[model samples]
Target: MEKSRGMLPRLFFFVSRPVRGTRGPARSTHVGAAGAFMSGGAGKRTAGPGRQGSRSALASVRAGAARVELERDDEMNCETRDSGVVAAGRAMTVLLDPGTGGAEANYPTRPITLVLGAAPGSGADILARALLPDIAAEVGQRLAIDYQPGASGNIGAARVARARPDGHTVLLSTRSASLHKVMYPYMDYDFARDLKPIAMVATMPIVVVMGNHVAANDMLDAMELARFNPGRYVCASVGVGTTNHVLCEILQASAGMRMQHIPYQSSAAALNDVVAGLVDFLFTPLSAALPHIKSRRVCAVAVTSQLRIDEIPDVPTIEEIGFSEAGADDWYALMAPTGTAPRIVARLNRALNAVLANRDVRQRLARLGYMAPG
Candidate 1:
């Protein structure tokens, strides 16, 4: 495993947290505020907002190190923005304007770094790497993987936050990875505030499962219990700021119920405890839950996708029961530091999209429960 890259010189930017729902990628970053967490108050702070803007926001590992700062736009290297717009808390679907040449020609003159926020065996990590070679071909540069998985992807994200704006450094993250904003109040970084959404590689669904103890027949049955019991029950999340937690939040809001939360860094940990009757239920990736669901070790409660899944078509959707939450196929998008040249971002998006469109590549990703972007 790669040890931390130590402290990066701090480089801050004008972080913006767009409250709008995701349209098509690109939005501002957020610096979450501080919180006390489980013991008493809110959890960690968001990474951006509450953040003081400067080009150099680096936090050196050992401290007392001089920091590196970034300069405001030089005006000479400016590029146009994607046309996607934000409407009333929702993001608009937008596409990149294909670049003809210039940057594309010089792209990848050096080895490129692909920063993965999820763990090694995670679906997000799998999807990003599947497209890596194809992406490298497009840029004519050797691409590389710089895995920085930790603190619910925040550690890796923070690394990206301080990377050179030159676009050589790219972060691999997903919607589930992006849920840290509202879930934790003490996060030090925000997806919308620190990174630029380059392209959405693929999206998978989030599923809800019950522990051995639930004893409920279906979602409605459990709903009745949760409604009656309120805070008596609990839900499990992979981490503090994960879609698992967000799904729980959405469920609570819609069902008019409250289920306390228990957080773990990985699904394996949460699933093990949940199965052992240590924790309660969890809303996690289908990729991780399939094994348990097949063995009947855990109960499949609801799916968060818009439609049914081929693997488990009959599973009820959160919507069928009269609510919609963050259950859309969870997606992983490639992001570069904000201020990364628009040219480079477009080049990477195009190359990666090309890979997603490949037949063989599609099949490989399918096995991982990843569906390429249209």
Candidate 2:
């Protein structure tokens, strides 16, 4: 007889009544019963005719129970598979959906604050103000400037670090942001851990300017005078622990010279003293020193960059004068409080890059003695 699909021939055992002390040999009985039913397929079975009738009823009961269990297992597996697909779909949607994943999608729900770590008219402040209009338009929000100048920009940076990490408040910081932690080890907040760098806006070389009273004609002469006069001459910086102050120290050490360091509250004050002949010399930002240099109020001796600045090509770099180790440059960048959403940081970076890419903006920055980094 042909076997039925999804059926297996089950074997059953039976024995004749055992004789007195001896057991009769067991006889094998076979019955055709349906095997575990599988989806889209069936099993085969075979059996002898002699015992088929005897064990068919018993085999049918066991086979029926197994079939029910297999069917239940198949249903459970299908449900689990479907649930896995749904869960994966939900995760993909969350990752790809701008409303959910993109923090920049609806950012700056309120007016944004751009914090400058320097006084008004300082290099950082000027750069921040210059880029504000363009960044504001790109972000589609009204932007406000907040000046928190103190501790060589540490005060302003700490304020931003303590602010909520919601992208509403950001900082326009300079190299002082990194220098302050080392210069003032007792500070309350950590610079590296608290601030996140968004993008570098512009960089300008620090120029070494001397008051008109100084007899030095160039950097070589100035160093010679400082080496011999030592404490007789004085050097001014915008503030203690600032890039200017540090650069002056480096220059002194490299040249084996000594000069009095006068720290002013702002670059304007320092530059004012330099031009007025109160301070012998100052290491200041190009932006702050350009106007005075042009007016011949303060003589531009040398720049601290590797290359000469285009605005004042006549002024050679420190390296050109053989003081290669004294080269220093100042830079301004946008930063947010640590833990600000990455999407927001990316958005701000894009806006800054766009602003710096404009030809007119580049020209304006160039006139201020600032250059966009390559």
Candidate 3:
């Protein structure tokens, strides 16, 4: 039940039975089966004594659905949209009940491909590696990670968007992908139209790190230098439209400075350049920059969060340095191709939530500077 805490209230599944006089493959309107099984917010259903209990549960579900519909219009930000429940569940009608001999009971007929938009050492990749072992155990199959890092995660996103929707291929998306619409107007694939939201898994803050050779000691000093000598300094990002790039833009805007923006295919490569002093600085996840910061290869100028993190307690937050506008947290979510079956999505959601519930898994994420949702 704890594993299903934040998931079941929004995810709905239906068991279809033939009505007495209905024609075609139309399902019964009873709603009892779904309510009875999903009660108590548990992933599995328990048998109820009568239909009365089911009816009451159905009413609650409908009410929740209506509230979600209303909230959908209010979700104007990228992070809010990523965590939306009912709006993402417009396709819930296709959710088949596993109790009725549906294919969801025996899902993952083959190995699943988890497509990541960044390289192996990136935040998305780190979270995936931390959780995949437990998720694979729950789902009864291996989840092969396919890294296609490039174009600020667009290349990997496009591959998953076009992949077959049988649930065998899913994208491990980040908040960065959601901004692609504004960043690249003419992108080949539509993120909202082409991808299905499964669940928002975790979130973490970005760190502003600089190479050892940089003349400045902190973010304010670096900004002053860049402000005085325009375009003399350089910053790097995974790609132009990524969260890294967006944060870079925010820092420059907030400080009223200019620095050349260099884009890379992966965070590891970008951080490497920063370490080698080929680039002056970059905005990266703490997990990616923590090692370098520890080794003193790169100095953590500031964190993009309201408060400082324990791992880097000495580093001040951007807000602490008077750049409140630049403070933001990065998040990760699971998504499949648009047409992926709802039943399959439900199965994956259950598996994912179960993995997130483990205390060890939560601790591992904490060490990586990520917080898993309850």
**Candidate 2 C-alpha lDDT tens digits along 326-353:** 5656767677887877677666666666
Worst 10 residues of 3 by lDDT: 68-77
Q: Give the candidate number with the greatest TM-score.
A: 3
C-alpha lDDT (0 to 100) for residue 302 of candidate 3: 92
Please give me the total number of clashing residue pairs in predicted model 3: 1
TM-score of 1: 0.67
On residues 1-374, what C-alpha lDDT tens digit does candidate 3 reach at each position? 01211221222222222112221123312112221111122112223233244355455644543121111121111121122222332421112234433236668998999999888888888888888889889899999999998867888999998999999999988766664554456888887678887766777778989888888878778877876665567777766556656567545543445566666776788888888778888888888888888888889999876667877789998777775555666767788898877667767776776787788888888877886765
**What's each prediction's TM-score?**
0.67, 0.72, 0.73
Cα-based lDDT for every prediction: 0.58, 0.64, 0.65
Candidate 1 lDDT by residue in tens digits, 29-108: 12211111111111133322212321122222113321222111111012234532222134423345444334555766
lDDT of 2: 0.64
* Candidate 1 colliding pairs, count: 49
Residue 73 lDDT in model 3? 21
Q: How close is candidate 3 to the true structure, as a TM-score?
A: 0.73
RMSD of each: 14.0, 35.7, 19.0
